[model samples]
Target: MINRPETRDLLAEARQVLLDSLVPELGGERKYEALMIANAMGMAIREQEQQEAGEPESTDVMLSRFLAGHALPEESEQGEQTLARALRERVVDGSDRELRAVLRAMTETRLKVNNPGYLK
Candidate 1:
């Protein structure tokens, strides 16, 4: 049997404590730094919970797939630049509905990691 204080719950609790206690005392740039730390802790908690729940295909892998589609770019800086240019053009033209859906999902995933509240 598992003991009390699961890893994800512990992280969430610590993040809440920081937000509730120390974050209020901080000011100026320090407050921004505290908030960043709290945000990172929240992401960590989410990651732990997702892993424990048997989520397959990590966020990174899925994000890459969503960004690049099935065909991964040629593995080099020049190729990356080419891919970026192509994606930018497609974004402006708005021709590829599949690409748009992939982008939306990818953006949602990124927003979830960066600021879950935005989704709500």
Candidate 2:
């Protein structure tokens, strides 16, 4: 049986059309703008697919792992806040090498879903 197109699937088709047809017809600034929009749409589609497939919806997993490096104190609202503050401070006060590694992972995680252009 045929199924209705899901929103993500529709967006995927739209992005394909934008690149295969619309982009070819454009030039200069307009072409760049279309590419930007297409890129955003592609990211959105990938995010949705990842979510539907039981993958993480965001970078919380990586950040949580990083934070887990330290022993979390007693679990409480205030305790959680303190732990978070401590984690932030540690990252900021960390050695250049340590900070660079953590920050690099953080930026890479964000870029995976936001704008991965620099990776190219």
Candidate 3:
């Protein structure tokens, strides 16, 4: 299980940690950064969806199925899933420049979130 701090007021703080310490070093280059950003955005979206669902199960089996891949899928009809969409998008429209932009944007937005202290 993830040892997320209990004091966090929002998931945005978690995103900051990811941006500062995780995204930059991923894949030995920036190639994984866009995928990470898309994944984060997807997670944020999922949180909202769950809140709307009212007592939605935490273990989303459908998402688990998408995650169980050598690489993520290419937009499954089951849903507008992010990991799969990211994988597909990367396959189709990925470059170092584009990936860098994504990583930078994610990191910046994460840093700008309404969280306590420095985004470190």
Candidate 4:
């Protein structure tokens, strides 16, 4: 296990510095770019916090379910790339209700991590 002042803490501190110090001094495009960078850092912090809290990423859970339901071989052999291809095929076919539900759940999960504001 890692020590204190973890990844999330570091990112949060960096984001705070960007917002508190750099952003005030910046102007126009530079300020906009800095804000965008800070926003991305905030997202990374959230993702790191979720992982630290033992929450699994939606894609991993969804892919595992897909592999099990289909009786596919171990993930080590088929890998995410193959599973992602299968998922893409299902999405393109647009016929499986289960796949649609899984996709929706994944989308909501991602939104919660990357842009929770959109959920409100």
Report the candidate with higher lDDT, 3 versus 4.
4
Question: What lDDT tens digits, residue by residue, belong to model 4 across residues 1-120?
Answer: 756776777898999999999999999999999999999998888777777765555566776686678765555555466556665666334566766776677676678679989999
The clash count for each model shown is 0, 0, 0, 0
Would you give me the overall lDDT of model 4? 0.75
Worst 10 residues of 1 by lDDT: 54-63
Candidate 2 structure quality by residue, lDDT tens digits, 61-105: 444544455554435544335445775777335554543565666
Q: Indicate the TM-score of model 1.
A: 0.60
Please report how far candidate 2 places residue 44 from its true position, in Å: 0.3
When sorted by lDDT, best at the front, the candidate numbers are 4, 2, 1, 3
Model with the higher TM-score, candidate 1 or 3:
1
Error of 2 at 41 (Å): 0.6
Give the poorly placed runs of model 2, Cα more than 4 Å off: 57-84, 91-111, 115-120
Candidate 1 lDDT over residue span 33-120, tens digit each: 9999998998887766655754424544544554466464546644335446666666433556655654565566667666779999
Compare the candidates by TM-score and give the number of the best one.
4
lDDT of 3 by residue, 1-120 (tens): 987653323555666666777776677546476556745654665455444654233234434443444244434453225544665756424544544444444444444332213456
Candidate lDDT scores, in order, read 0.67, 0.69, 0.49, 0.75
Give the TM-score of each candidate. Answer: 0.60, 0.58, 0.24, 0.71
RMSD of 4: 3.6
In model 2, pairs of residues that clash are none
lDDT of 3 at 33: 65
Indicate which candidate wins on lDDT: 4
